[model samples]
Target: MNETTTIFGIRAVIEAIQNQKTIDKIYIQKGLSGHLFMELQQHLSGGEYNMSYVPVEKLNRLVKGNHQGVVAKISPVAFADLEEVVTASLEKDTKPLFLLLDQIDDVRNFGAIIRTAECCGVDGIVIQKKGGAPVTADTVKTSAGAIFKIPLIKVDHIKDAIYYMQASGIKVFAATEKTEDLLYSKDLNQPLALVMGNEGKGISPSVLKIVDEKAKLPILGTISSLNVSVACGAFLYEVVRQRL
Candidate 1:
């Protein structure tokens, strides 16, 4: 992670939260208590945040300067409003393709997927607020700066984005090995969102139940599965091929 994107000190973190900055996570020293911390608590009361209570030693390792028992990771890219991005894409004349990630945990995988999506002309990428990888400096590096080129959206749940996509006349397809349908057989030349799941769990059963269709890439080799990023590139390029 880059120090530039991280802010320490209780007051500074509190200000960032108050300013409504897109914070990926917050680390508070365990058993920390002070007037400033109390003030920070007031701001954090009802909000949904990825918070961790760690030791002061961990906080020390996270930042060099005086942290005052709090350190926050701020997202380098501003999250786009999902409704606005979807609405704007709908107005465009070309078919809109969106990528929805279901709790993708690895930063490198997330970054590679973003790079591939941008290359394939995807309109936007949606991820959940809490479960997915936080956009760190490593992610920005691995993406080769493609993170800045696309509209990255964060939603409360992946299902919310799927529902929105379906309501907006976009078909949603979940990429999972559980399906017999092949990716090449699907007609990708239309407005649609593709759901890529986590590394281990695959797509959530509930999510699989709601998608308009489920498709998978063939695994001819001895390995039964491909890396999520590699699999994502294959799926995206197939869309590119079918559209052309």
Candidate 2:
């Protein structure tokens, strides 16, 4: 909450909601229960704003004054619709290139991937709405402002996004060690969606089934795998190389 843009009292936050301000997201102190809290709960359920429950220490760190436990943050970038991105990209004359992330939770890695994707001319990035890290100031700063320049699509289910891309004649490539296919062996010249999963679990099983191709980096070193962002750079630049 210390990183939040607006720190307000419970009443002030409720009033902000009532006044129809563009509240990006709201954080309420945990164990905050009462008529006012209940009223805020009902207001939040109406979907006018994004809200979450957090610890009281979080609120205290946000502000020194009596906050009464509520804070709101303004979103820096607008999210793109997954369906719209797929539809529009396929409609264009140029071949589409997408970077799909399954469950990446690291902010720095996410930002680095964005930077690489932008430099490599990826059309958009598809991230799981729930599991991905929040794109905060840290993300933007890490991306070196590439976050603003690139399009980001937050999807409820990543498999649905993959299916949408498949229906549009775009091939989906899953980057994982389990696959025998080497990255260079695949034809990256075609319209494609490259998927990279989280650090620990790799791609979720649900998303893995739909991937048209599974390719892995050629590991010649002692280490079995490269870092997620490093692998991402390799795959993205492979696309760039193929395109040229």
Residues 66-165, candidate 2: write the lDDT tens digits. 8877887655677788778777888888789999998788888988999999999888999765666666677777788898787898776789889988
Top candidate by lDDT: 1
The TM-score measured for candidate 2 stands at 0.85
| Residue 211 in model 1: lDDT | 99
Considering only N, C-alpha and C atoms within 3 Å, which residue pairs clash in candidate 2? none
**Which parts of model 1 are misplaced by more than 4 Å?**
1-4
Which TM-score value belongs to model 1?
Answer: 0.94
Count clashing pairs, candidate 2: 0
lDDT of 2: 0.82
Q: After superposition, how far is residue 18 of candidate 1 from its true place, in Å?
A: 1.8
Give the alpha carbon lDDT tens digit for every residue of 96-192 in model 1: 9999999999999999999999999999999998888899988888888899999999999999999999999999999999989999999999998
Any runs in candidate 2 off by more than 4 Å, and if so which?
1-8, 11-26, 46-52
TM-score of each: 0.94, 0.85
Clashes of each: 0, 0
